[model samples]
Target: MTPQQRRALDFIEQYYADRRIAPSLKEIAAHLGTKSRTRAHEAVAALVRDGHLVKTHGGRRNIAPAQIQLDRFTTAALRAELQRRETAHG
Candidate 1:
């Protein structure tokens, strides 16, 4: 996946973790600071097409991550990296 796509997925994952719900296209655009909601839509479409995400419940906050992506950081890896950065910066 491209970097932009990865960023969008990460934002989705974080959003799900924090809110216990999927974010909307607007939310995704806002979080990713994309040019527009249309870009967010395209990113989401790419994710769903590539099996990184799934839209469920006939289109609600049911957007969910699929089986773990192979080319991206696992949850633990992300936590470790975050901790490493915090420790370095702190």
Candidate 2:
């Protein structure tokens, strides 16, 4: 994935961590410093395309992290990486 897309995913994950819920399109746009929700929606679409996140239903901010297919060892490693990054930058 591109850096911009990675950053958007990081932001989305952090938003979930911070708020204990998904962010709305407007919130995502504001967080990304974009001018419109359309851009935010686009970013979200990109993330979904890239398999980093998923949206539920068709209303509100019902987003969730995508499951990664990994062996147990790799899964632990990835979880550690996510935790480290979240703590370092979130």
Candidate 3:
């Protein structure tokens, strides 16, 4: 990732950590010191493409960090639940 993109991703992760929600493109643009939201959008798209971020469709605040670190206990519990399920599900 480019330095600019890394900064954007860091800001996004921090925003989500503080508010439990993703910031809007305008917020990202403001942090990035650019009036054009298109630049922010492009950075987000690149991050998503590189698997550093995830974005759900049809929402203004859908972007989030993709590699959220989980505690070992929580990871184990999630794995157990998945094993119990009959079919693979997202």
Candidate 4:
């Protein structure tokens, strides 16, 4: 995923973990050091598009990781590929 998408995912995960609530577009923009909510919205949209996440509403909208239905082999391969990418990049 692109860095912005990753950051958006991180923000969603961290915020929910900390507060048990979803953050708004304004909050996302502020946390990412951007003044435009459009940019944050784009990032969030990418996450949703790539099947990495889903958005839900409970008064305010929230992002969460998508539920994967891959089999064990596919899941393992994906995990290994991610690890390989991380190791190579890091």
The prediction achieving the highest lDDT against the true structure is 3
Candidate 3 structure, TM-score to reference: 0.73
- CA lDDT for candidate 4: 0.74
Deviation (Å) of 68 in candidate 3: 1.8
Model 4 regions lying over 4 Å from their true place:
57-59, 67-90
> How high is the CA lDDT of each candidate model?
0.81, 0.74, 0.82, 0.74
* Model 3, CA-based lDDT: 0.82
Q: What is the lDDT of residue 21 in candidate 1?
A: 71
What candidate 2 gets wrong by more than 4 Å, as runs, is 67-90
- Lowest-lDDT window of 10 residues in candidate 3? 68-77
Clashes of each: 0, 0, 0, 0
> Candidate 1 lDDT, tens digit per residue, 8-38?
9998887766554779888889888865999
Candidate 2: tens digits of C-alpha lDDT, residues 1-90: 776667777777766655546788888888778869998888889888877898777678878668533332355666777899999998
Pick the TM-score winner.
3
Please write out the lDDT profile of model 3 over residues 1-90, one tens digit for every residue. Answer: 998899899888878766657899999999999988999999999999999999867668988789753332355656665677746553
TM-score of each: 0.68, 0.65, 0.73, 0.63
Worst 10 residues of 1 by lDDT: 67-76
lDDT of 1: 0.81
